[model samples]
Target: MTGVEHEPANERYAYSRTALARLALSDELRELADRAAAGVPTTNDMWAQPGEVVGDALDLVHQAQEALVRAVIYERQKHTSWEAIGEQLNMKRQSAHEKYRDAVAEWQLALQEPHYPAPSGAPVRGLRLHEAAYAPTTAGARLDAWVHEHIPAQRETEHPVTGHLPALSTAEEMVQVLDALNHLYGDSRTPPDPKARARVIERKAALLDRIAVEQGRPEAAQQAEEARALAAQLHAEAAQAPD
Candidate 1:
């Protein structure tokens, strides 16, 4: 009889049962199997075609078995007995030893092959003991307090031109930018003078124009153009106002 004709009905049923059991076990596996079986005339026909889906699956299985064998061989060469390795792999001691005897010899030969010096590099500098003070811990808090105690308070100086403006040496331009952002976003908590708001808007327009020209962003260019137009409109309205 031919191979198909000689095949037992019980063996075929067992194969079908196992395939169904695997499909039930995982939705992902079932989906993957479905995708592989799609467009095919018959699932059984895939086994007959040497370079088909079944062949690809068998190749993967062979690769996994070979990797496992190599791992077992490496472990055995490290003075690990076959029985100990078998227990770790959940296999019989005799089976493990028989399967990997040649592989173990190959691994032993590979280990004997040469050692070379790696390229040298600069040694890394670890963080200093005092630098640990920045960490978010009780020790860090105590260190910060200790440092603050040792530091002296900064003395304030009077400005020559405007005593009204504080001698804090703060970046006033940044403050103006922040004011403009707040005004544009309608954050009215910190109310600014009308004249100061107009000046800020003009300065912000100039800054945006400069940034737009340098960066080449269409959105920024559009914003800069709009700001300049608003500033010009505000200036014209201010000029037309009665003194």
Candidate 2:
């Protein structure tokens, strides 16, 4: 893993230091503002306090979300096959591929985007965030927190569609890209082999078949059939190939 993929924090510890730095900086700034405002007294909101169990837990959730997304990014960069990734993730190959394919593609686009110097003269606008703005107007369940995000009573059901999107490169090219990414991100864990992966898929299908029969779920049985078919194909492919 790149030690400090994000500024002022290291990924080795999942950016805990960086999150703390942000919290401390925010509190200092709030206190300074309180001293200047005269009417506004500085108060330690639960969300802003260091060593608060709930705050740390929330920050950890934020860290985990980012890490999960980045893990998908790193895996894609290595050009790891969806099957292997799925095997490791304990999900169907298609499910894993479908879940992360778009997000990973977007991340690749972002990394390719150009960087620019920060603008001067703006101390900061609003607050530094540790997680996705679940409620834009709220201070996130703090005692003094207020909701800023307005939920309209009615919203449009749909919008105009966009242009056709690009596709991931060929499998060979994707693998090459992943290797390049691995150089930067550093991959140490081994992915599942074809035989092992096939077995996993087969076993899952077997379980699904049993569940389908017992639970009387036709859909589950259909999915089981599909999984079995895929597993058989994978076995055939592995038998013909050299590891």
Q: In TM-score terms, which candidate is top?
A: 2
* Model 2: lowest-lDDT 10 consecutive positions: 157-166
> What's model 1's overall lDDT?
0.44
lDDT of 2 by residue, 24-66 (tens): 2333333333433442343645446465646545555665555
Q: By lDDT, who's the top model here? A: 2
- Report residue 176 deviation for candidate 1 (angstroms): 72
Report, for every candidate in turn, its global Cα lDDT versus the true structure: 0.44, 0.45
Per-prediction TM-score: 0.25, 0.28
lDDT of 2: 0.45
